[model samples]
Target chain A: MDIYDILFWVLSAIAVSCALGVILSRNPVNSVMFLILTFFAISGHYILMNAQFLAIVNVIVYAGAIMVLFLFVIMLMNLNADVEPQKGQLVQLAGVISGGVLFLVVLAGIKSARPVTIDKAASDIGLITNLGKVLFTKYVLPFEISSVLFLSAMIGAIVIGKKEDAKPIAPRDEEL
Target chain B: MPVNSTHYLFLSLLLFSIGIMGALMRRNAIIIFMCIELMLNAVNLLLVAFSKIYGDADAQLFVFFIMVVAAAEVAVGLAIIVMMYRKVHSVDINILNRLKH
Candidate 1:
């Protein structure tokens, strides 16, 4: 119909297709790239929803930071399509069946629900100033706690990922 | 001409389902992790849409919190994956059978 409607359709198509690419692409690297594309499309959807702040943050945190971390680990491991093991046929079938069932159920549920329309354009809730005010004032405790969680996560990642200086014992030697 | 909340809901549902399939079917640990991130993004999209509908900022704020937790989770989760790769020489989840005993 109009620009809003057209944008929504286009972005949703991009997101869903890219999501499929994430799963079906044999190369893990390509899969990561597809995931990043999906994030970008979802961020476009955020912009359409008038959440400008969230749209930016989604791009920054997801496509920018998290995906780069993924890429780093992927490259660090030197993963390739040849090395990725395939699941059994039956397992793959089951996964597809389950996912399809979920989609059908959720789709049916959504079809039955009444659509809520916004009579007016959305307010400034998505702006950085308003979001920051709420984050620091009303939600300050959780915000502070999340920082602590990040700290612990950083420490945990460093500890888990740190290379031990001790000469790595051979697996066979340890078994013996 | 205007997009309704239901439109966003359907989009989120599609993305989430794709994510579930990816997580279930993929053998690579990192790709599975990426699927989880995809699911989180789907939820973020839904939250922003709902916030727009309700004319409120809380849901958007919650999205922020979700993003924070997701980042931390990814950091620790990826580190764990790297550790597993070191031990097993592969990122295939099927190979991670040492804990079965």
Candidate 2:
């Protein structure tokens, strides 16, 4: 096996195991930490595929920002393994079985599909310069729209998070 | 054998299944949320792999947009979770079943 194959196996193992840790860990904090590790492994895969921009963005946005937010919330709530709730054992078993069935079904369906050989040689399409050109020229509308979505999401979060006022001022009070 | 598209496909599928299993097994709302993130990452990985296979940047851009949406979703979702915690004083989702009644 070549270096690429070795790296792929190693990274995939790390990712899969860490993802399991995310689910199996009793503490929410541990789950978050495992999820961060899983994100890092996924980012490594992105880099392996030469998608430098996505690798960086995944690390920054997912592992750095989003995970920290999860950690902060978990810490704020003081959740531990003891306090964590779990589904019944039968339900957990069923979940595993159902998920496995899905995996097997999809695998069987795709098994006969044509396998396209990946070009292992370096490609420029994943580079930031090319991606930026495409993003701004062809996808500019969606980019701007995403910014608007972000603004609305920000507003929505604020409105949802803020505490309700103890007293409501009536229209008659405004008239007075 | 060299790393092929099929290998990546299998890897992502495994990850996605694990995510589904986690989402089903966990009763903690935050953990479920995290499982959703895991599933999203699995899809992202597959998308990047496809982008590489086809020599296309569009899939990569789609991954970028997915990331954007995920970030916003986390912000709003966590706020709602925090609000729920404030109201119920627990992150256990079973407690929310009272909403139906």
For model 2, residues A1-176, the per-residue Cα lDDT tens digits are 87778888999999999999999988788898999999999998998899999999999999999999999998888885457757889999999999999999999987887788888888888899999999999999999999999999999999888886645856576678
CA shift at B20, candidate 2, in angstroms? 0.5
Worst 10 residues of 1 chain B by lDDT: B92-101
Q: After superposing the true interface residues, what Cα RMSD does each candidate give?
A: 1.2, 0.8
Compared to the true structure, candidate 1 yields what TM-score? Answer: 0.93
Please give the RMSD of candidate 1 to the true structure: 2.4
Tell me the tens digit of each residue's lDDT in model 2 across B1-101: 77788898899999999999998889999999999999999999999999999999999999999999999999999999998998888888889888842
Question: What lDDT score is found at residue B9 in candidate 2?
Answer: 89
In candidate 1, position A135 carries an lDDT of: 90
Model 1 C-alpha lDDT per residue in residues A1-176, reported as the tens digit of each score: 77778888999999999999999999999998999899999888877778999999989998999999999888888885456779998999999999999999999988977888753455677899999998999999999899899999999999998876555855676667
Model 1: which residue pairs collide?
A: none
Native contact fraction (fnat) of model 1? 0.89
DockQ of each: 0.81, 0.85
- Once fitted onto the true fold, the runs of candidate 2 whose alpha carbons sit more than 4 angstroms away are A166-176
